[model samples]
Target: MSKSITITNEDILQEIKLSCKTPEIVEQIVSRKVIISAAKEAGIEVETEELQKAADLFRLINKLTSAEETWAWLEKHSLSLDDFEAIVYSSVIFGKLSQHLFTDKIEPYFFENQLDYAGVVMYEVVLNDEDLAIELFYAVKEGEMSFSDVAHKYIQDTELRRKGGYLGIVRRQDLKPEISAAVFAVTPPQLLKPIVTSKGLHLIFVEEIIQPELDNKLRNQILTNLFDEWIKQQIQPVEFVKLFELGS
Candidate 1:
């Protein structure tokens, strides 16, 4: 009952090549292939037991209780059972290779760049007009109105407005460069003046700052980030030939 589109011809491929995301997609594929190759060379092969466990976890997560349902799901995704198992096996190899290469560097990296992982809970009101932004900032500073009340009434985004413009807990690096310095510079319960970015002017109120600790999850995250950077560097020098872009 679901609609589907198949990319069986060169036309679909050509269209994808012209898209803005084509280069990024190609980079990801190339980096992954490099990782898989390195993993194989290092003899970090995924075992049958690991593959089966991964497939079982996949089925459980998707609520595919029956074999028939699992098959149907695979069919819907245009994937065979073997293809799914191969994908899972490759993922296991990649993870193991990443862990093996970077396990020792995680703690040192975490200590050096601890601020990047620290989370901040912020209340923000973004406006397109700078004049209105400054007015609102002054109003909040003068104690004429509450920031939350102003955000609820004047914030343009419906979802953010509903939450009184609360941006929730976010890593410092997750913020834009212009906003990141300002947000991280202040302590909690401080209001930032109008900060302009490409998106718009943002008036930010810091609610809380969650400091980063080298926990298991955080350590794993840092390792993954480092692995990703390594992968990017590994593929950065390779040039892709645009065969489709010729005379099209």
Candidate 2:
């Protein structure tokens, strides 16, 4: 004999909150539904062969060598054959639709935001104490101590301290607005004074700036970002309803 338990919608919401994934899971479900709808509207087609190829790739990734192994994999994931096929078909359609819609927009978007996309190499020291941050900045500026040595000595994070506070190649938009403005304003080998932010004070040392080029890698990245932005905008007006509501 076995006993079954009934869970309400509120129970599900509580579990999601405890897992710290409430809003993210909701957004993901909405995004998937919206993307699938967009794919259908765009008349994107996924043939039997394409779906089979996707299934083959999935099987290969999972090391499912035979039909029985694949079936076992599906069972493990609690998916029927039809369910797995539908999932693969939608994924293929989504990929095709994304490429179809955003492939042409990559170049212009890249050119328009070239400076923001350009990579900057910098060193940073962040301190919670403003006075200590200012003191360290002046110490480095007056040549009383080497910046690298000072950063290694004072940076709180173990990984960053070991790296001597070096923040490798990054885009302008990757940094906070205040830090970005101050750092980009100074030339290479120049250190910006302590900047106050909610996090604390920051000392910036700009090393070099790498200009953005429309290479194959960057073009692909820009296209993906544009597609994601377009998808978000498309889904913004979509209304999602709870399938199961508590009794009134």
Prediction 1 global C-alpha lDDT: 0.86
Off by over 4 Å in 2: 1-30, 56-73, 241-243, 246-248
**CA lDDT scores, all candidates in order:** 0.86, 0.83
Question: Which residue pairs clash in candidate 1?
Answer: none
TM-score of 1: 0.81
Query: What range of 10 consecutive residues in model 1 has the weakest lDDT sum?
Result: 239-248
Q: How many residue pairs clash in each candidate?
A: 0, 0
- Could you estimate the TM-score for every candidate? 0.81, 0.79
lDDT of 2 by residue, 91-135 (tens): 788779888898888878878898888778988888888888888
